[model samples]
Each structure stands twice: as structure tokens, then as C-alpha cells.
Target: MLGDDGAGPLLAEKMLANPLEHWHVIDGGSTPENVVHQIRQLKPSLLLIVDATEMGLMPGDIRFVDPDLIAELFLMNTHNMPLNFLIEQLRDDISEILFLGIQPDIVGFYYPMTDAVKKAVEQIYQALNLHYIQKAFEPLAICEQ
Candidate 1:
């Protein structure tokens, strides 16, 4: 995890421990731009950017973050560049993008995450695992063999 700024990485750590066969998990750290190149190289059909974001919601709340709907003033994540710009660059190749965000209660310089945030992390882990497992086995062909 990223101390105060790494809730997404914490979720990623928990998710990658078991590792779903059909998915690849990468921790983008505080600056996603550094890793955007790697993601662009893969050119995956789906991209999910999970982060601890400031979306004017309650602390420890979870909400779907929409790039198009997000205003520029809310660009308070630790990254130097805007994430929407990155997404727009990959727009042509990437099929879908989902930004899952968890609101943080406190972001002090420390190792321990707050209890509310931890609960949010678990909720995200349990919920997303089921969805990914179902996604892994979906029909990929037009006609049966």
C-alpha cells in the first residue's frame, strides 16, 4: 500500500495474492503516468483504474468515478498528469474503462490504514472477485464448435 495515498494498491495486493487466472494486476503507485506506457503496450480490452480519490463524497465511501463526469478541480490524486488525458489517449484501442474509487477518512503519513477504509477495501475485494470470475468464463465466440 501507499501509506496515506495507496488504498488502491492495498486492494490490488489483496486481489493479487490469490491471482485470478484471466486477469493481470499492476500497482500504478502514486503516479500512474509512470506506468501508463506499460499499460498502453498491453492494449487490453478492459482497464480498471482503482484509486483513493477525492470525489466530494463521504469518507470510506465507494463510488464509480466517471472521467467524463469528473471536473478538473477534482484532479487531486497524487499523479502529476491528469488521468483523463491518459484514458483519452488510449480511447481508440481500449474497449472499456472503469475507475473505481474509495474515499479515505484520513491520509496522514503512516503505515496503518483506517478501519473504515479497510472495510471499504474488503468490500471492493469481495465484490470485484466474483465479477471477475464470472467474466473469465463468458462465451467468446459467435458460433459453437
Candidate 2:
């Protein structure tokens, strides 16, 4: 319910509506650590985490953050476990971990997402969907060559 803090969950809901094959979209909510077991069970090669972050940038700005810089960049600590710590726990299980950080305008409770953030979310959803669709067709394209 915290303003743009809902960015991650909103993205998760969008993803659930039209999921990609072989991809799992989990809404870790404010307690992402709780989903560690579920994530590990999937044995995914790549894990992409999307969350609202404080980057001292314009609202709606999105960046593909390096895991090492997470501690320095992540100012909001809404999650139960520190994001860096959670990453460390799953590093062994997941081959690649990606953090997509969206700069949030307001994080107050019961506030709705700002237009900038909402736009960013839609952009992210489209990009991911396009990427997966292209990937899904790769093998077929290669086979027909």
C-alpha cells in the first residue's frame, strides 16, 4: 500500500496475467526473504528482482543495478531481510541475479503510484515480454535455417 513501493507487486500482477513459458514471476512483497525457498525450488538460471529504490534520481528512472552496489544504492528497507543478504543466500542456487531498480517518488502508505512510476512499470513489462517472446522463437528460427 506504500505508494510506489507497490511497483514490484504491480509488475508481478501484470506478469501473472500473461506469464511466459518456463519463467516464474513471484511477488515477494515486502518480505522477499520468505520466498527464498520457493525460488530455490524453481532452480532458475536467472533471477530478476524489480523494486522501488531510492537512487537520488528522477522519479520513474530505472536502472539495471549491480548486485554489489545494492547495499549502497538501496535506501529503503521495507523487506524483512536485507536485499544484499538475500542475494548472498541464493547466489549458489541461481546462476545469474539481476536487480531492476525504479526510482520512487513517494513511498507513503495508501498512496497510489505516480504517473512516472506507472509508465516505467509498463515499459518494463513490455520489454520483458518482448525479450521472452524473442527467446521462445530462437530455437525454431535456428532449426529452420
Candidate 3:
């Protein structure tokens, strides 16, 4: 497995262990495109996508990225399709779409996540947990390393 490239799945596993009250977290893996049909079935009002992205920032830095700007940010090309295209497919069903991007330190095969990126995953999990607890529908603030 590629280092911090596994961040999204890692976060999905953590969320699954605790399980959110209203949120449905799916570990789409390397083929997120495969989940589009399932996501459409759920028809959630808000869709949050988490992934390790290359944003020219520090390894652990996290940002709330616009889907339209993902290409410019140079997201990791591990998915079956471009992320923006995926977002476009779900746009009609999902009222709000949020992309939570974590900057990866290493993307090589079999490399484990760096300390900073691991910490970022924890921070994101906690933030999402708190966000749902408060029943907030607004976008999250940028989470720094």
C-alpha cells in the first residue's frame, strides 16, 4: 500500500469503529468511482470526501478544497477517475460536497504513513466527530499539522 495514500481508508476505518449517528462513511479505496451508485442510493444531503492530496504544503497540512480546484492542487492519481469528475456525477443528488485533503509525505508502495500525516488523520476524525455531535451543517475550518 502506498504510504499516506491510504489516509482516506484509514479515516474510514476509524469512523466505522465508532460509527457516526447520521453520517455514512465509505472506504471507497482506489476505485471511488465504483461507489457512485451506492452513494446515489443513500442520497445524502452532504458528501464529504477525504484523501491524501499534493497541495505543495507541509506533509500533515489539511485543507478544505474546492472540487473545481483539485486539478490545480494536483491530487494523487490513484483513483479510477478524476475526483472532480466524480464530484460532478454526484452533484445533482448531494446538496453540499466537501473535499477534505491531507498533504502526504510519502506515496511509495509499502511505505507507512509519516508521523505528521497520521496525526492529521486523527485530527480530522476528531473534528468530524465533534462537528456531527454539535449537528453543524457548515464547512469545517482548515486543520493545520
Candidate 4:
């Protein structure tokens, strides 16, 4: 799973490149509950949350968080949680989780992603040993497990 507009689309593309992995994207525009509901339904083994809110990330740099840690952070910060809640509530359901956040150079209406964000995406793909796949990929299971 992936969320946040800053790097969500890019990460989704990278995950799709790996034929063995399946990815679902939830952007900032979606309500928080919608993302939480999807996580409940999919029961994904991992989650990649790319956001600017996480601490210690430089504009061109990246940060990684264990899914469990993210869940704690969410509970402490937002009264309503993001997908991290599911990771906590269903820890056994997840194999591993990574929160990949980039400090975006700019985030504004009618603006394209900064070069730094785009380059970071490429770096993440290399780190994950994946290539861009140019076709439809598998859908995340919509029914509850």
C-alpha cells in the first residue's frame, strides 16, 4: 500500500514493476477512513507511506520507518489514524512495513513534482531492485480476509 500525493504515484509505479509484488495507491485527496478501509480489505504484507510530514528527511533525502513505529506515531499525533492503525491492529497480517518519506521541495496547486522528488523515486526503485512495468497489474483484494 502507498499513500500521500508527494511520492505515492511514483512508489506505486515502482512496486508495479516488480511482477511478484502488488501495490495499491491512496493519495492525499482521499479521506483518511477510505485508506484505512482499503488496508483492512487488502491485508497487505507491507505498506510504503511516502509523505513530507515525517521528521528528519531532507528535501532530496529519504527516511524509513518500521510500520509499528509509524502506528505509534499516528496514535500520538492525529486523533484519527492513517493506515498505520491497521498495521498495529493486525500486526500478524503484515510481513514488513516501510514508511518512505521525502521532504518535497515544493507542494502547491498546478505545480509539477520537483526534480528532487522524481530523482528520489528512481533511487527508491533501484533500492528495491525493481524496474518500471508498463502494463496493468494485479488488483489488491477488495474483500475482507
Among all candidates shown, the one with the greatest TM-score: 3
Q: Please, what is the whole-model Cα lDDT of each candidate in the order they appear? A: 0.69, 0.79, 0.80, 0.52
Segments of candidate 1 deviating more than 4 angstroms: 1-4, 73-75, 132-145
Q: Candidate 3: give the clashing pairs.
A: none
- Which portions of model 3 miss their true places by more than 4 Å? 132-145
Off by over 4 Å in 4: 1-4, 17-44, 54-56, 68-83, 130-145
Residues 14-81 of candidate 2 have per-residue lDDT tens digits of 88997866568999999898899999999999998888977676798877667776776445657877
Where model 2 places Cα greater than 4 Å from the true spot, the runs are: 132-145
Query: Best to worst by TM-score, what's the order?
Result: 3, 2, 1, 4
Task: Give me the displacement of residue 59 in model 4, in angstroms.
Answer: 0.7
- Given candidate 1, what's the lDDT at residue 63? 68
Residue pairs in candidate 4 whose N, alpha carbon or C atoms collide under 3 angstroms: none
The RMSD (Cα, Å) of candidate 2 is 8.6
Candidate with maximal lDDT: 3
Q: How many residue pairs clash in each candidate?
A: 0, 0, 0, 0
| Worst lDDT 10-window in candidate 4 | 136-145
Better of 3 and 4 by lDDT: 3
Alpha-carbon deviation at 1 in model 1, angstroms = 7.5
Q: After superposition, how far is residue 36 of candidate 4 from its true place, in Å?
A: 5.0
Q: Order the candidate numbers by lDDT, best to worst.
A: 3, 2, 1, 4
- What TM-score does prediction 2 earn? 0.86
